[model samples]
Target chain A: MNEKLDITLTVNGRSHALGVEPRRNLADALRDDLGLTGTHVGCEHGVCGACTVLMDGRPVRSCLTFACQAEGAAIETVEGLADGDRLHPLQQKFWELHGLQCGFCTPGMLMLAAGALRENPDMDDEEIREVMSSNLCRCTGYQNILRAVRAAADVMRAEGAQG
Target chain B: MKPASFSYHKPGSVSAALALLAQFGEEGKIIAGGQSLVPSMNFRLARPETLIDINHIAEIQGVSDQGDHLEIGAVTRHATFHHPVSPCPLGRMLTKVVANIAHYPIRQRGTFGGSLSHADPASEWCLVAVTMGAEMEIHGPAGARRVPAAQFFRGTFTTAVGRDELLARIRLPKLPEGWGTGFYEFSRRKGDFALAMALAALKVEGGTIRAARLGLGAVGAHPQRLEALEAELTGQPATPQTFAAIGARAQTMVTPSGDIHGSAEYRRELAATVIARALTRAAEDAA
Candidate 1:
């Protein structure tokens, strides 16, 4: 039997030590070993952002990143977006705007959008399109997705102002 | 599709990485970010027996500004160059282009050295690296060597890199005070590979052109530096007429090949237009 390599990773503020092959992708490792399937796999070629996850606060395609490459790295999958049962603002906007149809691309889109919003909370429509262009959703024509991002931005801003 | 089985080694130091390269030779491949290599491996386009992962090598990551030149580690992420606070406008522009490359997720995992080593003629980073006259520092079993941008790239998907060598850092000389730069590319979509691209850098003195450097990509086997056009611009007055003449000279400098997105003649014409536009913008910036 091929010896499994030891890997230590921090996911969603929790640390885990696992044994796996060096060739295992972060997306596969998250879904199969850790049982966090929120990070979807689409196009596998980095063209599609279905497997997007936050690595040290930056969104990266988990499908293209080797698990060995992510050793000792801090990762946040879609499962970490919400605080317990309380939904993230982006998730609320996604739900309110019907930003998804099949929901396969939702988790990735939500993560990317959340990252973008955190970086630029006041992002306008064109800016949202420019940033969201990376993620592809064949089910949605991208109009509602754009609306969801804008709606979420507004919610984030309103919450900030209220506080 | 899963990547073919391969042994992986994580070297902690640059010297250790080079030693691994020497031990494995052509049977090994270096993985940084793994944006391009992983996909290629899964497709069976390239399958090596050993994979030397260099992400943990501390000496081969980050950016260093040494007064006269900027030393960029090979493993520096593309996002580092794109940050808004970048000292060099050229560096900032590269970051913006890289941000739009594929998508944010890909850029997060892609390294500047990986992109340059990939040497895709259509890649914007390769064209910019050539235009800026960047020098690549390489370490191998034979010791360390530096190759100037002009000689670094050999051909499409090829460079001066050897099997037992790893690119360690990229050295870019600080631009002269009057130097102005511009980069432009036309793609099918926002994040698609460039159909045609142009980059121009020029130094102007009192309305006269002191020096000029121009480069074009995706139109040839390798990115071409417009020496002929640059020669015509030197010592001439920096004006619309001078730019027009340089554009005319650029038309004959490259013979773009036809591709799925555009025809040969169309790319040639687009090259001329982009060159003119880039030169004009760069000249304005210098002024």
Candidate 2:
């Protein structure tokens, strides 16, 4: 049943050509094949949102998306969130605001938020909570996740205003 | 869970996709957005030998003004409706109703046409299409044919779309001037499917309801329009009492089957409550 296709995945500003089966979802392709383990797989069937990632600048459930379907699309995961040793505003705020206690859902939450805030940079705290509710967080009760995303949005907005 | 192995075919255009569908027929399943189909595939509920991925088909994407109606391409994702796609009241309805269609990520990839084709009883888009009297334009080897929403949706997880045909685009009638829309749903969780949902569009003039459209979803096998109630609304005074009266009647109109979410009687109550809420919102805009 495994008919492998040689596909090029453009992820995190890098391209990786790998021969993967048609059954390989984007989450498994990233974690097992490409060694980008930041994406967590939970509920594997699109719920839980632990495998959320950006496909062409929009957040989508990587667990529900086949790897071959993602060819030529730009993918963003938690691995691409930071700039070198300097943490991204979102990552920094998550740290300062205590966004994670379990850390398993962190990568998915960060990527989901990063994609959401990019789409609507001026989202207020209430709007942030609405969008951030896409991913489930069992720890910290989601108040801190909402706080982190809101704070990061402010920083991003200020930086955006300067330029 | 992983999906079963299948031969993948990415068609660059609608014609190519149709050709693939015609060739594979029942064996080839069209994959657009893959929000619902892939998950069912993951559970092994659907195991197609050939998967025709329509993501690459650029011709069937985006929403466009088709003069009398808005033509939404089959591959138009739910996220596309987050903003008003038109200046008409229909645009407002789309934006208001889209947020309830699962979470942000699922909406980003879930296509409107795919939702209609999937025909999930709880789908927001399905309710919208049925309420709006939308027309579906399907493409097949024979030619293109149009199916109205009333006839398009057959049952739960079923539709009029043929095995060799593709729903290329959806045509939603541009609502008349002075119409206001309302949508309300009761879901247990933020992104879960609704237990009961209602949508209404009302046009009020001179304190009288001129035209109205009403629909209920998730409480039954398929989304249903309260056509008799819609007729009853015309010439009636635009008042909350009148809306509540119709809402009360609507509760008995739909035969909502029971599920794990709620009992049949519970859904009947929910249906009535949601109808009242939706009608109230529509009237707020009409006011």
Candidate 3:
């Protein structure tokens, strides 16, 4: 009943060409079509940022964006944060700071914080909290999550200065 | 929830998009940022037969300076206002207002035109458009025409732009030199729907108000300019006492309905409070 269109989406440095229905959102395609299930769907609306991913280095709600509309766009999901064995600084900080309780909103939080940290490496605690406010976390009460983002930002800034 | 089945058409140019809109008429819906429309589609509230994706039309993207006025393309992202594509007076006002939107991620995708065309009374863009006296550039079968922001918004989720016409761009005139402006909104949470909002701009000279533009949002079916209050402010002394009196008088000037957010009486009270704060801040900025 739905028309299918061809699209090529580059996610986490890997390009995948697939066909999706016109109504298929980018979040569903990233999870169902590609097997990268890190991107979660909470509200399925733009209000909640659970399905957020980096598009061209900027955070965007994948649930609201159509997969076909994302053709030729560079996307980054939670799965892209870690290497084979070494975890990204954000993941390490989250683990150390106890940023996750149920871990449902972690993927989206990590992706958004990654984008935020990249844009503002010297971001303060208030800035980190402000950016993470969109993604809802029922478990952590957001205190630890803010700490994790702040710690990760410091590490990222130091690494950037060195390299 | 997933949106219903629909045919998607991605047009490369404005003419091609207009052609499809004319062909489909009411059966088609243009998708720009998709931040608002996609969610509505998922809820089955808005189900158009044809989804015309206009993300690739480069002609209606980015900012252009028109000497006296700055023309902002409809597809320009809200995040672009944070550090504007180009610096202008409008950016200073937009940065304050855009932060009140959903979040950083949503701001990255939501477009200036999409929000204006949506015409949500609570939207920051709609309120500011009315405050700035923006002119909307529309394109259709008959070619192009400009509609003032005052006339562009007809009602809640309604605009003067026809189904066959597209809101291509919006032109915001540069505020007079030394003009000070303020935008304030009250939402339950940081990104929630606003209950009451106000935008104020003041151009004061020799301790007297030369021009005062004030607008209110989320207090009615559409955002409206406070013409009576604005007239009262003009030629008046730029003093906090005068602004406070005008703000208190503004409560009686609006007609707002009660909803889940707050009571009608409560919103009226807030209208006075926000308007007063906005006016005082704008006056301070002018000095």
The candidate maximizing DockQ is 2
Docking class of 1: medium
Better of 1 and 3 by DockQ: 3
* Model 2 lDDT per residue over B64-103, tens place: 9988899999999999999999989998899999989998
Q: Each model's TM-score, in the order given? A: 0.94, 0.98, 0.97
Q: Which residue runs does candidate 2 get wrong by more than 4 Å?
A: none
lDDT of 1 by residue, B1-287 (tens): 77877888999998998888888888989999888888888777878778999888888898887777778899988777556424665555455456545566677778889888988888777887887789999887778999999999999899999888889999877676668877777887988888778888889999998988888887887888878778888999988888877777777878878877888999888888778887887888889
Give the fraction of reference interface contacts each candidate recovers.
0.61, 0.89, 0.85
Please give me the DockQ of candidate 3 compared with the native complex.
0.83
Off by over 4 Å in 1: A160-163, B84-100, B205-208, B235-241
How much is B117 displaced in model 1, in angstroms?
1.2
Q: After superposition, how far is residue B238 of candidate 1 from its true place, in Å?
A: 4.2
Order of candidates by TM-score, top first? 2, 3, 1
Poorest 10 consecutive residues by lDDT, candidate 2 chain A: A124-133
Question: True-contact fraction for model 2?
Answer: 0.89
Residues B179-232 of candidate 3: C-alpha lDDT, one tens digit per residue: 888888888888888899899999899999999999999899888889888999
lDDT of 3 by residue, A86-155 (tens): 9999999999999998999999999999998777787777777789998899999999999888888888
Cα lDDT tens digits, model 2, A80-112, are 989999899999999999999989999989998
